[model samples]
Target: MGFDEVIPAPGRAWWSPVDQGAFVLDPGTVLHAGPGTERVAHWLRSTVGAATGLLLAEGRGDHGIELGLDPGLGPEAYRLDVTGQGIRVRGGDPAGVFWGAQTLRQLLGPEAFRRAPVDPGRREWPVPLGTVEDRPRFRWRGLMLDVARHFMPKDGVLRYLDLMAAHKLNVLHLHLTDDQGWRIEIRKYPRLTETGSWRSRTKFGHRASPLWEEKPHGGHYTQDDIREIVAYAAERHITVVPEIDIPGHSQAAIAAYPELGNTDVIDTASLTVWDTWGISPNVLAPTDNTLRFYEGVFEELLELFPSEFVHVGGDECPKEQWRQSPVAQARIKELGLADEDGLQAWFIAHFDKWLSARGRRLIGWDEILEGGLAKGAAVSSWRGYAGGIAAARAGHDVVMCPEQHVYLDHRQAPGEDEPVPIGYVRTLEDVYRFEPVPPELTEPEARHVLGTQANVWTEVMEDPARVDYQVFPRLSAFAEVAWSHLPAPREREFIGFQRRMVAHYARLDALGVAYRPHTGPRPWQRRPGVLGRPLEGPPPNR
Candidate 1:
């Protein structure tokens, strides 16, 4: 592989030809980690060492790999120098060291991504002599995984964490709750899992499809599972941002605790965990008891996820129930809220203050901007860039996750063979060319653009393999968009990206990722007849 072949392309890199010789890793080579870099060293030994059949035991030998910290570099910046003498990795911080290690694995070739050495008899692994200096272009390179719609087991979530790290993505926004199911165990609310985690059946494809997966479908992560996930991600320098839908997309929560719903408006007790897709009208009532219950849930959540931002899904919440309920109407009047929109805002603002007081920040979907947002609140602009632009201009931090661009669950191609396609056709190139920070924003406004994230909504993704098919390749491109400082979106060289992908694909293969091939889905990857809701007009730009 050439020195320039790094994905999420490094800031700068150069290499000497093979005629100059290369650094070779064999059973004799050791790993030496300086202060503050023990974690990264351990990871390299456990992951790369196992893959290459090298011991990489702790030592300070002349032919050893050295890990050190350089405070002068950017927090996520790293410098890697590989020569015949040895390999040296220095980072601004532990996270930077870890990222450099990821690049090192890439340099070692695809075989380094495997679980175990492919050829036990072959002992040496050669890394071309080179110098690579790199850092992320954005702080919040993220992937929002919706585990609620089609419950992914604990191991599946862990697997995704590894995948995110592989692409230099640092945030795992775990959408833990939605109308279809709740995937986190709340000890105070045991029924959330017992009653709300499963559905009687699931709509096989799009809601329009006349298909059904006529079997129970649901599972949740126990509190211990959550702790493990958070700890594991922290080891990789990835934060697990847990999302709990509020007001809307919360039928499952209401299903478990009828008292949390607007009981006066509907027999909320009659609601089971929603078995189908789409926003649900059974929203949480705007009552003190409802607030108290979620507060308890958040209290436990905070103990598990120490991430700075808590994502309270404030998008697509239908207000019909709030409009019809006498109790909701009286509460609105009592609070002097002008309308249901104001009530929704009031609910979000309450949590904003609550979370802020506890030294955490609140982040929600763009709808949280409807009435007004607290000064500390951030926005996940999913509808389009308009929300992100508005939020950024208003001095609110923004994560540009506009569905039109980075919705990985959308079909990669317009071909009929694509599996359960949804939304606009966002091919790999579309993602590679996606520009998260809109040019319209002023410099100050653009600073609020925390970064970008690709959201994988699982309405159509039924299993881990399906999730993999939708996320890879495009996610690889998205990673570049998030990490690299490339030319303008239109000017990005897709042809060069395709060339780099030739290597990345082999890495993905070694990692056992079931990604959609560049040539389109393989036979089994296609779902011939399953219907999809494909938009027909020009793709939305805002």
Candidate 2:
């Protein structure tokens, strides 16, 4: 069983025989059997193919196969044994066999398929050989792409979707509306896309002044385009949850339909791009017409996206406009509400009831946690983990996307040389070190924590390459955190995992991804040696 003696046979062709007991690993290479012949054969071939490819690339000729399966194997169980004969993956389910194949692929180097001498005791493949009953850790591991701030083209969206699928991520939250642009086409309100989508001015740089350009900058996804994107994501098992910012971030909507505004002022031009980082003044007028308008929009949204959950953005909505408007005050009196927050809550509850009747649940940002959470609504905590904690405590489902750790747009480092502003410095190690479930939660309450997501706001991320630069490495870390539970932040196990990531990066390179390189020490290495003492400040400039 010494690794150095085995030589891989590169030109071997894998074959499966009708007898459910044995398999030809490659031509004459025989692997002693299992019950699921077809499934095992598929696993063996794929693993051998991948491993062979890896070995050939690495200039190593090592090859092997091993099999160990007990009787009464459940549908989920799969056992992979690697030996000199080749790798044999036997599982009651084809999927389990496929996963075992992936594990084997990971063991072999990039040149595995080519004939090469297996490194003997010098390199040992540590394959965990035990019962692993595994499944997805979260129902929704999502990444939100804010298309409205700056519209990303259709092809770019597809590329993002592919990346999500590659990491086994399951949700793509499309933020399709904002004060700057309305991205989804509404046929009933053609102007929503035609006029509201286009902007005359776009602010440039983090601190740059708003550039007033004569050129109209705008684009939107047609209904047909959305249908295609939805179908594409569906094939990859990724749901595209569309978000339409309501009650607030409705400036673009208001521009499209002036009647939806509290003021009859015709001079209201939709913001080209927001200059400020916080809430905007132009919010949806709390009037009967506004409700009817959003109802129509939601009807169109339901037809386009078949996802069970609809995101109505309820974040960063300032109540100044509503508080100052006479019509809003009248509505408040009519509805017997206390203040603008109550009015905002009322608006959200209306959609909650509307979506509920159509067999869909409403999802909103943590801002919805204000006033009161809508019954049966799920909260996406972006401000921090406290919102998710509060929601779970109140018997509500939550997605733990704390900005401190999960905001992908945050600069990975604190150095001013970073591309984006340092919102909250979340290095790849920070992301990898995250634990989705808060430590303070009780076992039963923890069950309410649904999953985690990484938000790419795209305010500073204008170019697709920059997006890739920000997402990868850190995203890989978040992917692991979302899919499985790992040890504590400073555990040596994580350091070991980080070392293994070196190989994973090679695979990413082979896949032609432009991922950021991990250049820092593991989290354990960076722990403060002495408590309550500030570290030396950055050396006084030169």
Candidate 3:
């Protein structure tokens, strides 16, 4: 494949023909590492070498692949030059060199993505002579994976990290908690996992569906498991942002400890881990005890995740509970809050200040903007661009992931064949055309647009395969949207992108991704009789 065919399309590239003779990676090929590139050298030796079955011994021999750093390039920019003589990969920093290494692997063919070489005895791996100078359009190219609705084991999460790295995506927002389940262990709150992790049954499809799976479902990552996940992602230059939904989507936590809920408004002790989808009215009580309880949870959480930004879910919270509870009313009156919205904002503000005090920043859903945004909070604008625009203009950072464009759980096509089709139909091309920075923002305001993220909500996705079917192919498009410098949404050259996907499909297959084929889902991939919540009209962007 030529450089033009690379996914997320390189910023600039020049390729030579096969007749010029391909540079072969033989048994004798050595790997040379320069200053500040030890990590990349190790990654090349371990990851690429393991996949290609080459020793790639450490040395400075002639015709060896060299990895080095260039002080002039951007931190995430890299330059690759390959010829019959040898290959040179250089970047401004370690991350750039690592991304360059990813491109090198891509050049070696689909087999380079495998865990082990298909032909163990074969040593020669040829790559065409070419030069690529590339850098990302956005620093925070991310994917938010919701594992609360349906748990993915640690290994699956690792696989996704690898996938994200392959596409030059650098952020993994792990939604660890929600109304349905809690997927992270807190030592201070042992029962969160013991009682809140498992649900008695699960909604088969949408919350409105009549079907139910009458079986237990739950899982949580141990502290060591989380440490491993963080280290694994760090190796690939990816950040794992942990999301702990607060105030709202805390039924699981409340189920673990009834005191965390509004006892006056509801029978908190009688509640169980949520068995269905959609918003839950069982929000946390706006009390000092609730604050202290979550503060303890965050104290342990900060130890596990060291990312600069911590997500406190500030979305879809119901006010009916606070409206009905005298305790909540007293708290609101005591704090001089306007109403329940102000209370929700106050809840988020507490954490924002708490996190800021510990040298970390707070990020939450756009709903956090309703009452009064905290001083040091970022917005994950999921509903649409309006929140993002407002946040940016107000000098707050924003990650545009409007549901109309990047919600992967939404059906890929308009048909019953799509598995548990949810929300709007957002096809692959639609994602490719998604522009993160809105035109309404002035140049200065646009700087607050940190980057873009594609959300994968697992409410209807029961297992990894179903998640794969919904995410991939379209994720490829979203990756380009985040990384590549492209024209306006309507002017993007999707036909060219489709051509590039032809080669990427082979790579996905080699990596064991059960992505929905471009034409449509494979017969086995379809959920025949499952119900879905498909809206009648198209999204505004469409």
lDDT on C-alpha atoms for all candidate structures? 0.90, 0.66, 0.90
Indicate the residue-level lDDT of 100 in model 1: 94
Q: Candidates' TM-scores?
A: 0.98, 0.76, 0.97
lDDT of 1 by residue, 259-307 (tens): 9998888998899999877768789999999899999999999999999
**Candidate 3: stretches off by over 4 Å:** 525-529, 537-542
lDDT of 2 by residue, 1-542 (tens): 11111111101122232232221233234333345444444434443444442221211123435444443444434555543334555655544454344444444443332233233222333322222333346768899998887788998898788667556577999999887788999999998998788776555433222433345566899999999999888755678999999888877777777677667433355333343333567888887888898899999999999998999998877787777788888888999988888889899999999999999999999888887877799999877789999999998899888777788877676645455343667777788888888988898889999888988876655567667777887777777777654556677255655765776676566545667667732222111221122212311110
Stretches > 4 Å off in candidate 1? 525-529, 537-542
Enumerate clash totals for all models, in the order shown.
1, 28, 0
Q: How well is each residue in 196-235 modelled by candidate 3, as lDDT tens digits?
A: 9999999787766777899999999999999999999999
User: Which portions of model 2 miss their true places by more than 4 Å?
Assistant: 1-133, 207-216, 264-278, 520-542
